[model samples]
Target: MTSEKKTYNFLIAGVPYKLKTSHDDATVEELVEFVNSRMNQALGVTKNGSYQNAAVLTAMNLAEELILLKRKAHRELEKLEEKALQLSMDLENSKSNKVLNN
Candidate 1:
């Protein structure tokens, strides 16, 4: 796989940080833009005081959300796989029955 380094700038707790990650050129820019927007919103929420702590809390919340999303995605994938397997078995059984009838 081809890896390209991309730089993303975002605000965390009113402080700006640049993050560099290796990703495909096409999608990395979009990911960077999204990260910047989310960081800005989180920073805005904690503008009054203790920006650093607020940023940390925001990161924790985002991480938890990601974990839950992953779990949900895995469950959906499992269900789809089971459905596919059942379909394949049914197809095979149908073919065998047709052959027996002939």
Candidate 2:
């Protein structure tokens, strides 16, 4: 018999996130680290505030930044794909021309 994997969704601020693990005993320490890193990048601890509020605000900021970065990466990927296609076509054309000349 095989046990089904468990998936959990967690939201730091407003973003919905999903992760799959083998069991309920899966440690969330990694997830916490990821969240903390993003939060720190988004909101540097430059102001005096409660830890909970700061965490929430940081998450919100990080979510927005992540979205923007994802969009930018997608656009860059599309451009690279287009360039690859063009290069492949050019290579094929060159090969065909060489064959005709031979």
Candidate 3:
């Protein structure tokens, strides 16, 4: 189903922004808060940095966090796949052993 995008007005790093998104009001507000927090942290680290620089740094930091999370998730999925394979092999061996003893 197609839904109309709604305008969400928010402030980040003291600057006002308007976004057209399908997200609910609360989700937009939460994202705005996250962006502001990231930018503030960037500014804190680079005391003399401009707003643009802080914003860029914040983006880089968030990207890094996303990449690390993706990597961790991939590793976990690999582990689960290996465990499943092992369980399948164990089940097959048990079935064969039961037939041999019968």
On lDDT, the candidate that comes out on top is: 3
- List, residue by residue over 1-102, the lDDT tens digit for candidate 1: 256677766554346677787766556667656655666676667756466655676677789999999999999999999999999999999999999999
10 residues in a row with least lDDT, candidate 2: 41-50
**Whole-model alpha-carbon lDDT for candidate 3:** 0.90
Candidate 2 accuracy as TM-score: 0.53
Question: What TM-score quantifies how close candidate 1 is to the native fold?
Answer: 0.67
Q: 1-102, model 3: which lDDT tens digit per residue? A: 127789887788888898998877788888888999999899888868789889889999999999999999999999999999999999999999999999
Off by over 4 Å in 2: 1-27, 36-52
Candidate 1 Cα errors over 4 Å, as ranges: 1-10, 22-48
Instruction: Report lDDT (CA) for all predictions.
Output: 0.74, 0.71, 0.90
- How far in Å is the alpha carbon of 85 misplaced in model 2? 1.2
**Position 34, candidate 1: lDDT:** 66
- Could you tell me how far off, in angstroms, the CA of residue 31 lies in candidate 3 after the best superposition? 0.9
* Candidate 2 lDDT by residue in tens digits, 1-102: 126677777764345667776645435546656775766554456365455667777767878888999999999999999999999999999999999999
Q: Tally clashing residue pairs in candidate 3.
A: 0
Which lDDT value does model 2 have at 32?
A: 55
Model 3 alpha-carbon miss at residue 16, Å = 1.1
Let me know the TM-score candidate 3 reaches against the reference structure.
0.90
Q: Model 3 residue 2 lDDT?
A: 27
The prediction achieving the highest TM-score against the true structure is: 3
